[model samples]
Target: MKDDVDTIALVVVLVLFAAVTVLGFKAARWSRGSSLASLDEWGLGGRRFGTWVTWFLLGGDLYTAYTFIAVPAVLFASGAQGFFAVPYTIIVYPLVFLFLPRLWSVSHRRGYVTPADFVRGRFGSRALALAIALTGILATMPYIALQLVGIQAVFEVMGLGGSSNILVADAPLFLAFAILAAYTYSSGLRAPALIAFVKDALIYLVIAVAIIYIPTKLGGWTGIFDAAEKKLTALDGAAGNPADFSFAGVGQAWPYATLALGSAMALFMYPHAITAVLSSKNRSVPRRNAAILPAYSFLLALLALLGFMAIAVGVNPVGLNGKPNAQLSIPLLFETMFPSWFAGVAFAAVAIGALVPAAIMSIAAANLWSRNVYKAFLRPGASHADEAKQSKVVSLLVKFGALLFVLGLDKSYAINLQLLGGIWILQTFPAIVFGLYTRWFHRWALFAGWAVGMIYGTWTAYNIPNPASGAQHFGGSTAAIPLLGEKGYVAFTAWVLNVVVTVVLTLVFRAFKVAEGHDETSPDDYHADAGEPGVRDVATPGAAGKAGAAAEA
Candidate 1:
């Protein structure tokens, strides 16, 4: 994968990188509000984004560099298992459609900045909120690292990195991460919000071209799939395992279905996903986006096909270690298949795609730490300005933390951790989503459930060895279901236990007459909309019944 640097592509990449750096800074004043010294403004884009802005924001940031690099790489590596991402993206919207508007409305009316904020309000449990926040930040770290891994893949293809020294190999990525930290520090959520527009356009443009033009060279979709299938079946036959390379076979079906289902449940639970949702101008904005956001699904399906195209084109990329690296599949595919300048544009798209989501993810994680961890424990009386300052600083640290994961661990480790993160995050669904409609589950019970789920999920993931590398733990996302003797997503299995524990604990707590704590929200809060009379800037937390406070005041 290392060669003479494509001078033309390198220049294009740097030029585009500099261009987005400017946008990230200019976004600070794009939609001027009273100030940017608070979580509402600094971390959630002042909650002023309308439908189209929200659309681009979610579109670019949500799909992420992982979608661009990892999904295709997985397809290139294993065939059908990677296609799980496609159906999961489709399944996620309808699941979100049912509950996200309710979340938006409640958060819009109540000044909630994170999912943990909602949990705190609904359950009146600081411990539960802390668990939710910690899980989000923990789950988010590897996901962010994967984005850097995307940029690293692009750099490797361009011959910018492939050194024996860690610092030398990662210097270009370090520069990209530094620029991202700077803009996010200065502009906060606005940085990613503005940059997302360019990211979306470039990704669509690059994919549109690659799908049409590259397939023509490879003799079209028929040849691509035929080549992919032939290669996959031959490998499976060699191993004495007959998986249908064209589709997930009988043995693979349960894991595929559960992966899709569990992943769909976990997608919106990430702090970054909630940050985008909470940034919308109003409740209607989220609902509208939910219905329309699936447009990205069509794009995702097309993106996954690039994997087969990689297989068809006979792409065989090696990593800096000179080992066959499936993660390099797409980037090297572009480098090999396209002209230098066009390949440069494609690389820029992948690199910028990583930046947008990485910024958002860092912001989301920092906000979680500030609101739930810092303010909740260390400085309970902190001001909005103080919280904003803390989050700005923490966001920088979070990116570096991701850099640590990228530099220190395996590339596949980031991917597996993301899957594990999904398992961890799904545990919060019962606490946050259920509390939206009813307070039937006691707060302590929810906390206990989360603990059980987190511990169980982590243990199960730790035991599933990677068959290829022979790593003894965290190798894959799936495990066997209880009593079923079949593999399903560990996250879903953990979630099932999480719910059962929560239900049983709730009954026991009720029987023993344990206090249910307090609920700050009334029924109206979940259905309230923007500009409703006396709706305070719900992005900021204050007062006993702040949800009903007037914005104009």
Candidate 2:
């Protein structure tokens, strides 16, 4: 690929980044609350964002840079199997429809910031909540790392940076993340909620242009698919052909379907996704987003085609020391096709896509720590001011931790950790999702199920191997169990194991007449917000409250 370090396009991207960074900090005053004193205000934008803000926030939250670059990269590498991302996204809305409202209602009524908050409150088990929190934060770190990888691609293609130099290449990555961290700490969820509009608009423009322009340049979709099919079918003569690129077969279809379903189930469970969910002013916003967000899925269908288009157009990645670097496939395509200026805009969009989500994830992780660990274990009597102070500090630390992931981990390995994230996060489904509808399962049993599922999923994922890919641990999720040789999707299968363990143990404990934990919430509590009676141990007494409130008004 021809390289230009000082192109006007690259300059535009840097300028846009600087603009968004300024905009991010400016959000501190956009919807300033009276005080940032509670989890409601600090963790969830005071749970008051309207429908439009929620839509942009969730859009930015879900459609990540990983989705932008990697989905097509996977298609470029493995053919039709990678297209499963489309169907899974399509399926996720109906799935969330069944349970997310309940989660929102329950969490809102009880002032819960994290899913772990609900878990602890519902099951009355701090241990179970801790497990949920840890899983959420761990799963999110690799995802954050992948976002940096996305930004790095734009920089690399522009000839400004690469991963070769730790400080030289990564300084910009750190600067971008540092800006995100500072704003999220200052403005809470509102920073990203506000910035998401700009991010999503840029992404939609880039993707829309690329979808129309690229296909036309490559002789349309029919030509692209045909060319891709042929190229992928041709095997390497040097390496013995073990993996087949043929799109048809039960072996292929089953894994594709299962992976899609597993991914959809795991998507909303990520703390970042739910953080966006809880930020909505009303429960209906999420349901509406779930129904309408599939419009982006339509966009995703277009994005996935780029992978096939790469093959049709003969867009080969630049080889690194004679070995193909699959990660560069999309970057090389952009470099080859897009004009310097539009290409720079596209690069800025991808970089911004990474930034918005990284900030949200860091804040989500910090909320988990402040509420569950820092306040719960370390300082039970901490004031609201102290809690807010702690969360802001923790947010910055979390960003640095994610920066470490980008610098220290291999790009491919970082992506695999994200896959492992899906597996680990899905383990929380049985406890968090199921508990929303029923409290029938024993709290202790839920903890036990979590422990077993985490162990099984981690152990099974660690043992997967692909010789052609040279991926030993956490390669692709599979049905085959290690040592035992029993087959199942690690996430869905482990979830079943988790549910079974919880149910059976719940029955046993019930038969023994175990003493259940107290439920601090009432039915009305689910509908309660800040001003409601007993919403947070606050009392707004009758006559004095009414007369005083009216006079102040």
Candidate 1 segments exceeding 4 Å error: 243-246, 538-553
Q: Could you tell me the lDDT of residue 184 within candidate 1?
A: 93
The most accurate candidate by TM-score is 1
Candidate 1 TM-score to native: 0.95
Steric clashes per prediction:
2, 1
RMSD of 1: 4.0
Q: Which candidate leads the pack in lDDT?
A: 1
lDDT of 1: 0.86
lDDT of 2 by residue, 151-239 (tens): 77667667655446557766667667777777888877767877888999998998889888987887777888888777776742234
Q: Please, what is the TM-score per model?
A: 0.95, 0.90
Residue pairs whose backbone atoms clash in candidate 1: 111-538, 534-549
TM-score of candidate 2 against the unseen true structure: 0.90
Predictions: Cα RMSD each: 4.0, 4.7
